[model samples]
Target: MINLTINGFEVEVEQGATILQAAEKIGIKIPTFCYDDRFKPHGSCRICVVEVEGARSLMTACCIPATDGMIVQTESEAVVEARREILDLILANHPLDCLTCEKAGRCTLQDLCYQYDIEETSYDGARKSYEKDVSNEFYTADQTKCILCGKCVYMCSQVQNTDALCFVDRGFETHVGTPFEQGISESTCVSCGNCVSVCPVGALMPKRREKYRYWEVDKVQTTCSYCGVGCQMELLVKDNKIMEVLPVTGHCNEGLLCVKGRFSFDFVSHSDRLQKPLIRKNGELTEASWDEAYNLITSKIKEIKESDGPDAVAGFSSARGLTEDNYLMTKMMRAAIGTNNVDHCARL
Candidate 1:
């Protein structure tokens, strides 16, 4: 264990733990731009710089490991100035379009600027200009809004294992792009949208922005219905309409989702979606109420069981229903209805 003093609070953490992790253990919130739990520590943003008692200069808390008897000042005057200057440099190139930016409500850069009281840019320098690339069906890449934090690049290569994006050019001209600057659709991009989920700014965004803000949506934890794997997902719903589908880290997926799980959710609100139960009446299928449908199904099942014995009745459950529903259907067939011919559409 290593002991460290952060903002006069002495704390102990496991050996080789970063100063940011030590501070986080004590509820000390340190603003970060390039730090993510899933990625290796790449102190590129310099937003979490802090002053150590014996260090030559301010150190990035996200990468610096905690040491025994270390005295760290996360909010010291020098650290504050360094962070302000860093933000100023970032803002000099960043576009001032928060109001119209698709990531306005959920942008980490905007929230950090607000927390640091940075209302205006301190450095007025030439800004990088690049056209928006809407070639990807799932997302748009706007280089002008990118901070070059490399989060998306890391996610693509490390998490998704698809090296579709890379840092192109050098220094001031550096931007995330595909090979030979080709369109996203032309590259090995799978449109899984894992890049957009990790982006801190408006550099990467969904092509179609939802109508509601981030806070306005009700996050409902559910499983993806696209396949039998049933990867967990967070359904962002507003006004009874699904606004977005975010991948949740749990179940079999482990923060990973295929293109179908991430982008093929529009069918939930499709006009052709069935809203009521359907039954075949007079050789034609027609919509029916819940009570009517249940009564008709009950009568049909009872007639079959009595006329041809309960062994002749069969039930085929669906994978679309929950596990409990399938279990109940099996129970009804074997115990109540006296049949052993129950099967699931998914087989397993």
Candidate 2:
């Protein structure tokens, strides 16, 4: 354990823990954009700079390790000014279109700007701009809105291991792009959406625009039912309809998701999906009451057991079904039906 003082409050954290993690442990909110648990701390944003006693200058708290007997000031006047200046520079390049941006309420950069009261930028220069890349069917990339924090680039390479995004060119002209300046749709990207998940601004956003504001939507935590991996996700719901799917951190999948679990959710609300039990009547499939469906299934099972024997009965469970549901189905086939002819799609 290493002991450190942040804002005059003594706190102890595990060895090799960064100052930002130590401060967060004690309920101190340190604003950051380039620091996430899934990736290495790059400290490119310089938004989490803090002052340390005997230090020559301010240090980025996100990557600096906490040492024993270290004294840190998280929000001194100098630290505040430094953070404000960094934000000012970032906003100089970032477009002022938050009012209509898809990431308006949920954007990390917007939240930090509000926290630090950065109403405008002090630096004025030619802003870097690029044509919007909407070729990626799932999301759009507008380089004009990017702050070049490198979170998305790192996420694509380190976390997702896709290496689909990279910084092109040199300082001032540097920007996130694909290899050979091709569209993301033409790259090796599998559309897992991890890059979009880590973007701090509206630079990357889903193609399907959400209808409600961030506060208006209710985030319901649930496990992804697409596979056996059991990746957790947050369903952004508005008016009983799912607006978006967000990856949940620190779960079985560790805040990562495949393309299917992240983007193949529209089927839930598809018009062709069955909402009730259907049974064939008069040579056509028609909706049936729950009781009627259960009665018909029970009668058929009894007839098959009596005439063809229990060994003839078989059941197949879907991988999309919950674990408990599949377990119950297996138990019913073996214990109640007196047959072992049961299997799940996931096993196949």
Candidate 1 overall Cα lDDT vs. reference? 0.88
lDDT of 2: 0.89
Where model 1 places Cα greater than 4 Å from the true spot, the runs are 228-230, 251-254, 298-348
lDDT of 1 at 181: 89
lDDT by residue (tens digit), candidate 1, 130-222: 999999888899999999888888889887889899999998899889989886889899899989888899999876656667878899999
| Tens digit per residue, CA lDDT, model 2, 170-193 | 988999999998889899999999
What residue runs in model 2 are displaced by over 4 Å at the alpha carbon? none
Query: How high is the CA lDDT of each candidate model?
Result: 0.88, 0.89
